[model samples]
Target: MADMNFTGPEPDLNELLAARPQLGLHAQDGLCLENVPLNAIADQYGTPVWVYGAQTMRARFAALRDAFAAETVPMHIHYAVKANDHLAILNLFHEQGAGADVVSIGEFLRATKAGIAARDIVYSGVGKSEAELETALSAGIGQINAESAEEVDMISAIAARLGVVANIALRMNPDVDAGTHAKITTGLAENKFGIAAADIPALYARASGLPGVRVAGIAMHIGSQILSTEPYRHAYGKGAEMVRALREAGQSVEVLDLGGGLGIGYQDGPGLSPAAFAAMVRQATNGLGVKLMMEPGRYLVGPAGLLLASVILRKQTGKRFLVLDAAMNDLMRPAMYEAWHGILPVDAAAFQGMATPADVVGPICESADQFAKDRILPDLRPGARVALLDAGAYGAVMSSAYNARPRAAAVLVDHGGFELITRRQEPEALWDGEIVPGA
Candidate 1:
């Protein structure tokens, strides 16, 4: 598994700024994303807000698409909706001719709401309720990646009931090590993600003869935060071999849904090169003659969004602690996966302050409600703001109202200005739908 932490000294503030060109230190204003200053948004909407750069996302999508095109690799890019499900974010990708890779009906609805055609969406998940399957089928979904034999049967039954031929793909458990964090890895034998490789042959044959289903192809997702292509080379090589074997058995294989887990640099470094990744993919599946599809979540949006937080207080305990109003409920990656995110001050003056070690934490009651431990950060006084970098993916969508702290507001920056995408949640709204024993 790839270690999420830096063994040596973390990159200095300027190094971090240099790595992400979208952000910069304004001479008079503060840290700016695109053209709007981070301090400006923080001052207006308050801290614990999310700000996403529209141009950053646009550039990233173009780079990924162009890399594949450069390698002469024909593939469809499905923006993974679970990363950041905000409608504005979805619409931005859709405008760039990207489809959606959804795992639930809610996400499917969000995609369609954002003007993504139903035919462009791919539904993938292990536990799709009957209602969810029916919804996707009725709405004319592009493909459904079935993870198990029972799910295949369930899809068949629902499709037959609806009188529609559901396009399906057998998700193969290639059991390849993605070399990512263990908690996010999904393709191993012990994980409950997909059908075992040994069992795919028999199941594929059986599903081929089933009613109300068209077996389009095979799909596999090894894991998330995958920084290298070695695992993909191994996994796709197995997938291509399976495609050949299935064809020899008189089964049709049309699409290869190479599930996405492309990683980004959380620290100040180029995490993964799109050109290298594309070249490796081209070599791995060189003459497969199958329609290719990839579902990239973090790679596209992770670097485009950031969490703006304010220093609540500086506690000088056994270890220096910089507590912010934002908690684990707002950004769970650190608490959940021990993830590393670049922490930089929003003020231009503070951006160049003397570095000192401090534990960046939140007000959440949990012991794990920390973002960085002993992180070298500038001297941020109480009320000073900082931007938690690379938070566009698996950041807000995974947020909750834990500790009854209202979910933070969100903003989208573009064209030298910013707009409020989601307003701060009102605390009373937390219990609005509750039934208090008929009181």
Candidate 2:
């Protein structure tokens, strides 16, 4: 809940376009993602639609994979499914030889449905119910990152009953600050995320003696939207020390799950460099012979998608308000995380126009539904279209029907063409399962 207000000179539209190469302004097509005009999609599917660039995702995955390869680290990349759990996105990562890092059974099922083998999916969450553990164990999940001692015992009992050995890593809370938002930070001792470092040695020893549990290694995740590698170095250094301690105490360690929080540049600034991150991991855990695994969510997909919305109308009073057809129900990050996403006009002329400050908002009744405060943009008349940039992750996947607004349609742009990945939710579908009892 940091200061949400933005007070400064407007970001240059051309500069924004330059930062994200996937997007460009065309003379005839206006704003194009991977050279596909966004306005065409908005016009055909109606406004309040989501457009994702498949090529962009593929390039990002390659970049991260190659970065680790350059450092000579045998890294296993797991696509964090919670960020954007669309089957198309999951399948694309699977094709790139990436595994799935899921936190829930539904996400696990979704990853498998996308053709990701259950054995390639690693379950990580603070709370895993008995049913969920049974389901995951029944499906032969590859690895589970146990958060608490109780969870370890729970997994042990369930696995013993099923007569199967479970492969798990102790998720250690390194108490390192990731210099991110308060809500997203998970590595602190106060955060209810992982087991404390002091408890790991004893837990590892205890779990090793259990009937159906095997202590693979350790896992640690500090936070989301992390820009610096120093926090990771601190956390990973602690993890390495714990690994050594466990080994010294006669324990076998195998895999080190480096939880993902590699952030993207929300504004025009540079994001966390994969090369720098890989180098830091190398420097921190260089001598440890354990296998390296990273679960990256935002960094892989956040910049590859956008929300296309049409201007409902422009209101002017003491403050200029630009109302959009898309509401908080469509993209909640702006209201939920107070996140900043670059907004650009779909028309080339509008992009070149003189900018003025206006409060960009959705039609939701709540005041918190505002997307941007005092954002500078061109005079977008009614029916004008705009694209909210860097919304590929934590955008549509987090959407809801709070105001009874049906979810928006989704299109995937690839190979110089676009196709509907998810059709817009019909209005009647909202209440399809509801019942007016005793009417």
Candidate 3:
């Protein structure tokens, strides 16, 4: 939503959410973010936890899906498992008829466990192990997007060994820049992600000769957090061209997978709208004649959740610094990409007026753990709660307990509002497998 077309004039989270209140995600019970402060949530669910609004997830899926459905391109929304792997969130998307783009065997198992059909799950990753492959095969996964020629042959061999024909697609690099955060870009030629587009023909020829291998389609993942549709159109157009070529060469290509890099609102304008993004895909691949597939992780869940942390210490050294109990280990994007996230007091009652310019920081040893630098905030005090906005995507999914600290808990807010989803990791589990040599 915050016009990512430009670099200057960056909008923060407060401004972003205010513009798209619908995306702010309210509970089915009418619990809106504006009315419920996360501090109270932290107090109830404990600190360093994730909270999601079920209503938000459902709405996002509908908005994005409806936009693409207007055209003939059959859009398949595969929720990216890496975004936020909470089973509850995954189940919510599943109820909305969303498939999963799983990258690991564990994710595959989890998806099936949550009652998602294995036929709806698509295995996609650059570095999948033999066990992971077998797991997916045994589970009857619909298709596997092989990133390398070797993987294509290997999977075919596995499928042959198992006496089954495998559905496969080549993940091709379109050699286009997604113009997003570099940490997330996956489709560039310089990156070690997908197969190059130029070699698609040769690879198809080779794959055609492989036994028990069905080259079902082609896929292109330019990057993550893409705010523009130009890059998607470019990548999709190439995929369309490849599909045409493959069919001419007597290869059966039935699906066209456009990798998900859709970003949600992080700072303040409305985060990238799925409806707008979907329209672009429909126009680009309207008559491709193959089932259109998209794997969106962040855009579906990022706006539905928040990371609730407690203010630990407030220090001033000619500048106000508010330290929090949660650190980079809890939410790593802000430190990793220098990303922007909205910080709100847990108490909406305290937000009636402007306060002071303070840095909302975490207790991580690294100085980069700071959430916001030199941003005006309320006069935060110890024990006060602050809500980290748009944490629904990579927030808790990428979390680590690096500093010997326990992991946080997760809660779900539905019509009933705020039910515990996952319990925070306790210190006992940090050393649960440790041995003291028969002490």
Better of 2 and 3 by lDDT: 2
Listed in order, each prediction's TM-score against the native is 0.98, 0.98, 0.93
* lDDT score at residue 98, model 3, on the 0-100 scale: 92
Task: Flag regions of model 2 displaced more than 4 Å.
Answer: 1-10
Candidate 3, residues 95-152, lDDT tens digits: the string is: 9999999999988888888778999988998998877887788778898999999898
Error of 3 at 191 (Å): 0.7
Q: Model 3 TM-score?
A: 0.93
Q: Model 1 lDDT vs. the true structure?
A: 0.92
lDDT: worst 10-residue window of model 2: 1-10
Residue 61, candidate 3: how far off, in angstroms?
0.6
**What TM-score does candidate 2 get on C-alpha atoms?**
0.98
User: Candidate 2 overall Cα lDDT vs. reference?
Assistant: 0.92
Off by over 4 Å in 3: 1-17, 20-40
Pairwise lDDT winner, candidates 1 and 3 = 1
